[model samples]
Target: MSDTSALPRPLLEPPAPQPNPGASGPWTGLRTFATAPFRARAWKEFAYLIIVFVLGCLATAYLFVMVGGSLYLSVLVIGVPVLAAVILGGRVWGRIYRVLGTVLLNAELPEPPPFTFRPGPIGWLRSAFTDRTSWRALLFLLLEAALGMVVGYLVLMVVALTALVTVSPVLWAWKDPHNVDARGVSHHSMVQFGDYYIETWPRVLAFAAIGVLGCFLLPWLFRGVCFLHRVLAAWLLTPTRRDRALTELRESRRAAVDDATATLRRLERDLHDGTQARLVGIAMALGRAEERIATGGDAEELIAQARTSSKEALTELRELVRGIHPPALDLGLGPALETLAARCAIPVELRVLLPVRPSPAIEAIAYFSVAELLTNVVKHAAANRIWVAVLPTGSDALAVSVRDNGQGGALQPADASGEAVVAGGLSGLAQRARGVDGSLFVDSPVGGPTVVTLVLPLAGPQ
Candidate 1:
């Protein structure tokens, strides 16, 4: 049986219509070709194609010279360093191609795993020889060079031909003897089609119209070629799916262990410094009061001290309990978040719209994720306003977002080893979220708004 009891009332209302980019009307193709040459996207892609073309040529030339010479000299021991250099160069170039493809082609390729080298020249040689990634990169460089030369030449010819034909009326020199007949009268050859000579002025105008049409079609055609190049790059540049999955699993396990350790240490410190210390003070006060009473000396002051110590201890214990699980959560996630917003250092606009209650474990994770994000904003982001929202991402997951309008340059930068530097408190929060199979994303550029989002499965920590 299916459960519908938890569904929200808002689900009954119709959702607003969203425009589908892929859905096309009768004039869609016409409109695309008409606007292709003028759109910024087309220009950006053209620029990207140009860059790929240039880099491909350079990579091919360099690798052919260096790698070929090294292979030829392999009998000599000196060739070892040269071979290592080729492999190293290929790896670096592969990374550059990956970055470019990501930005230009919008291809989301998983990063190749980091290479580990042992001590000494022999180790370096062995690693270089065994590195499949570097060799694949070298192969890609060779392929890209051939592909780029052909595609680049074709694109250049198309553009140049289009420009010449389109501007023939303005730029064609009729006074030149070659353009004129033996009679020395005005004459020029027009671009030809099959069985058609566009030699007359009227035909030349028609040829210009054809050129205009070609200009519009070329950009879209180039885009198709670029997509094919992206496919080739993905196959050659990224690690295999199995390898990527293993890497992610290892990282997740490490993060889970680290997060648990940090949490336990924090709890222990809080207990030792706050509640435990207060309890010890209370015990000493009570002991002193008992001594005063038994000795028949002034006991009033000692008794009063005991009462004060007890109150302080009780306060510390309440605070400690709250740290473990906020008391506000007893009322449910929405109300708890509202209570949290009320205590924020900066003004927070909170919104929560969930169709059903998430599992308690998921709820706890969501709560702490929000709390940590808000704390980060208060500490690092000098902001005047914050907005926190919790809503269902789908039937299976909920998304919580905390956004602040502050100076935003808060990101976990990658180290030299290409791993994200996870030493900061914010990185710890991300790891904690990851422990539950939830994901955290931070989008904070310099000088402004920072938005952090955490998404958790509705079924809880899976």
Candidate 2:
């Protein structure tokens, strides 16, 4: 790929406009309020709220009875199975709630952990005793049942209030006009506020206007309530911080180990096919040359051919050694990185401000890391400038940064494909760094300028 380092850096573009599903414009606030009660979404949410409230009340009572009974009956052998059944039942309901939340509330709840079966009776008991997932699910079920009733009721009330106010004028008009009090005035109004009544046309209009105002505020109010519920569900439903961290660590460790194994296999294959093959050819050529000399034939031609094979073998050996560990790294990281910079497709401004040198392994890692990062910039980032820096981190580490003025946007996104598209380019680098107790951080916003920083401990991999 061509490195357009001579080209000038482009101006950063403004952020693209995001699509908004709600109302817009100067009068959007009033328009939303006036039309809130009529919106299909509002009605749908109200219907969902009603369903949840009734179901939650039933569920709350049932779970409370079942769980309470189970705890009381724990002294009996039947209690153990009963409690286990309740927990397992809770997980089933938890999954159902997750689906409901996704459809009704648009909350993307994470998948709960899988239930693992154990082999013997003792093993089964142990599994049940240590089932964190089941316990969490039961807890969420209890919380959802108890809180769902209150939150769902509040949501319904908000919708009902808006609907009532919206139809106040028509409701008052339909009231029995002949009904009157001792003052000869109608006791009922379109809508009643304590003793006050909205009976007159002007008053009805004003009350309807207030209803319209309520309608506009409904969406936001509804969202606020839903947001609280979503947060609660997320906290109670998703994996905890420790679980997530451990998961990440396990993945990284697996990646690193797999990468190392792959690399070793690749190296073995390369040697067998390249350097070793060339050495075998050279040996055969020399043997022929020796045979020619003894037989008093034209040995000069054979010797020359053998010499060419030997040179080729040497070249292959050098390339293989370089792949294993760059010879430039023996001098130090600074010179090694400079050699890498010199070979980059783009103009890389190299800076090394290391007061101390790290171990050989650390130097090799720094070298290859810079090499790969620069390669990415040259190939992927259509940039005009690149800066590479390697600096010592005080007493016990090394920091390497690669910055480019490119059309950035290389950060990983939430991809449901579970494919390694994001992990393809920089993930290997990250895994390699992790192998040495190091980290790789990328800051590439969707415009220009991409910065990738790698940090390693001086003591090297533990």
Using all chains and alpha carbons, the TM-scores for the candidates as numbered come to 0.58, 0.77
Model 1 global lDDT (CA atoms, 0 to 1): 0.75
Instruction: Kindly list the per-residue Cα lDDT of model 1 for residues 257-311, writing each as its tens digit.
Output: 8767877898799889887887788788788878988998887886787788788
TM-score of 1: 0.58
- Lowest-scoring 10 consecutive residues by lDDT in candidate 2? 1-10
Q: Supply every candidate's count of residue pairs whose N, Cα or C atoms clash at under 3 angstroms.
A: 0, 3
Maximum-lDDT candidate: 1
Clashing pairs in 2: 32-216, 33-215, 33-216
With candidate 2 superimposed using the best TM-score fit, by how many Å does residue 339's alpha carbon deviate from the native? 1.5
Q: With candidate 2 superimposed using the best TM-score fit, by how many Å does residue 54's alpha carbon deviate from the native?
A: 4.0
- Candidate 2, residues 196-299, lDDT tens digits: the string is 76667898889888878787787767666667667767877777787766566777689877877888998899889887887787788788888877888887
Predicted structure 2, TM vs. truth: 0.77
